[model samples]
Target: MPFSVYALGLAVFAQGTSEFMLSGLLSGIAADLHVSVPAAALLTSAFAVGMVIGAPLMALLGRNWPRRRALLFFLCVFAAVHVVGALTSSYGVLLVTRVVGALANAGFWAVALVTAVALAGPEARARATSVVVGGVTVACVAGVPAGAWLGGQWGWRAAFWAVALVSLPAIAVIAATIPAGRSGAALPSARAELRTLAGPRLLLTLLTSALVQGATFCAFSYFEPIARHITGLGSAWVPALLALFGTGSFIGVTVCGRIIDRRPVAVTAAGLVALTAGWVLFASAAGSAVAVVALVLVQGMLAFGTGTALISHVFRLADGAPTLAGSFATAAFNVGGALGPWLGGLAIGAGSGFRSPLWVSAALMVVALGTAGAAWTRRSAPALRSDVHAYEQGSSDG
Candidate 1:
């Protein structure tokens, strides 16, 4: 991997930390600002909407700019947004700042993936992406927990201020280290990228991406309440358990490449199965602390592992439309992110047990799995039947 890749990873780490830290501080933020928890949750969804809106727009507008300059400029914008988020006092103003920050966050990831792929060349492209995305894994493990803890101890605003502090060094590092390469035509244009959606397999890939996220996060969005109600854990235990779940995600992402490279479809199927099993267990047997913890860990692992495979599969199917396909996967993720929390909240409101969300999650996973299996079978049926018929005829002749 290029040294520049590591620099990019640092910037990614900072961005990921800022994006995810809000989850930890949600309750604190609501109490501090005198808003409902659900309303505060809108900030999280706002970020997703921002990413969905900004990723393509930024990719297209910055299509002609130097990759390094584009990245640095966005990082600067991201940092400035953090400052806005940190300094704001009014609830409405803070919400707008969060949206602005998320917009910058989305563009950064879209651009970073293209730059990382270009920098790594054909042989190590997957490996390079893993390194860049590893930052997100780390954010889950460390950033969210720390931010939550800090918010509980001091104030929610402290967390955003801390993120701004981290961004200052990230900005300097990005300016100093990343190369100013003129990758004008290194990847496809946004229009060319969008055209990849024209392929039949693209829909399958998008469905898979959306389902995997929807399944996991539907259960995941209600994690704090689930932990308290189902596992008999106190409110204090939520962050620690979430941190543990993040640990599982880290391990999953780290090893996912090997699993997918060996057998993409099979591994994806297995992951869906594992995720379904995890939810089933959570619904039925999560009363025990050990069982609950184990289920959460497995859920995180399978969900993220499956997502990595699904996104990579989309990239492969896109063939000529690398960046656009990547953006499509990003968009699917945002869509799933939006759906998961909303639906999960509805389940809770319906007076079902905490496990009700798990049931909903399992159902979504079943649909996703069915979609993936159908698509794969359709894609492979002709070749498989042709090979089998020829082999049978040859055996009869012998």
Candidate 2:
């Protein structure tokens, strides 16, 4: 892979850390901001809402700009927002910052994925994506835990400052490395992009992405509370547990990358099954520290492993409009991101307790499984084949 690919991954690491750091910071933010934990958790949902709108909208806005320029613009916005977030004392201001930061984050993700796959070419698309998405897993492993620790040691504001500082270097690296050119074929017209997005196969695949993310975040949005209240862990152990989850995600994405292109369906289905099983085990083992830790690792692996395949599948389906397709996939994941935490919050508010989210997560996975199964059955239908055929022809001509 090109160095630019790794640069993009670094950029993703910076953005993803900011996006997920809120999970670990929820407790601290709630305490400092004088709000309930569930209320603080709404920050995650707000970020997701920004992402769900930002990706596709940014894709359209940057449709004609050089990918490098677009990326730089987004990163600048991301870094600026984090600085603002760090200085904000009011909960309302912090919430607004989260949404604004996420808009920049979503734009970065949309362009970065397209750039990674373009740099790697057709055959290595999954590997390229893995290299980039690996940043998210790495953030899980290192960045998020570091942020959590920073939050615990200093304040949540300190973590935001750390993220902002880290983002500066990413901005410099991307500007220096990523060439200022269109990464792939000329983008399709807005009408063509919409038509391709409207296809049943693509739409179903996007739904699969959403369902998978929804299931993961349902429990993940409440991970700290689960660790503290249910598993009987102290605040000190939260970052460590988050790191363990990240370790599992890192390993899962690494392994999945190697095989996803060849066994997309099997890998995806197996990951979903493991995810559902993990959720069930987690719920049952909520009180057992060892069991909870083990289930967290398993769940993180299965969750991100499935993500690799789902993203690759979307790329295949959207070969005609790779960047827009990537944007759509990002939107779908955030839609789930927004819905998962919101629903989990409602359950908690209803007196269901922290463990309630795990049950909700399992149910969402079941829906994802059914959606995947339905899509798999129709993978061979003529309409799908024709789409693939047209994509192949376009690639050859380009």
Q: After superposition, how far is residue 107 of candidate 1 from its true place, in Å?
A: 0.8
Q: TM-score: which candidate is best?
A: 1
Instruction: Give the CA lDDT, 0 to 100, for residue 50 in model 2.
Output: 91
In candidate 1 the C-alpha lDDT for residue 142 amounts to 85
Give candidate 1's error at residue 30 in angstroms.
4.4
Each candidate: what lDDT? 0.76, 0.86
Residue lDDT tens for model 2, 36-85: 99999889878878999999998888878898999999989998988988
Candidate 1 local lDDT, residue 165: 77
Give per-model TM-scores. Answer: 0.89, 0.87
Error of 2 at 369 (Å): 1.1
Off by over 4 Å in 1: 27-38, 184-189, 381-398
Worst 10 residues of 2 by lDDT: 179-188
Candidate 1 residues 1-398, lDDT tens each? Answer: 77777777777777777777877688888887889998988887788888878877776667677767888788888888778877776789888987887777777777787677677775665566666766777788888777877788888888887777776776776677667777555766656767777766788778878887887778878888788888889998887778777788777766775556557777777887888777777888867888888877777777777777777677667778755555666778777877877788788789887878888888888888788887787789889999999999999999
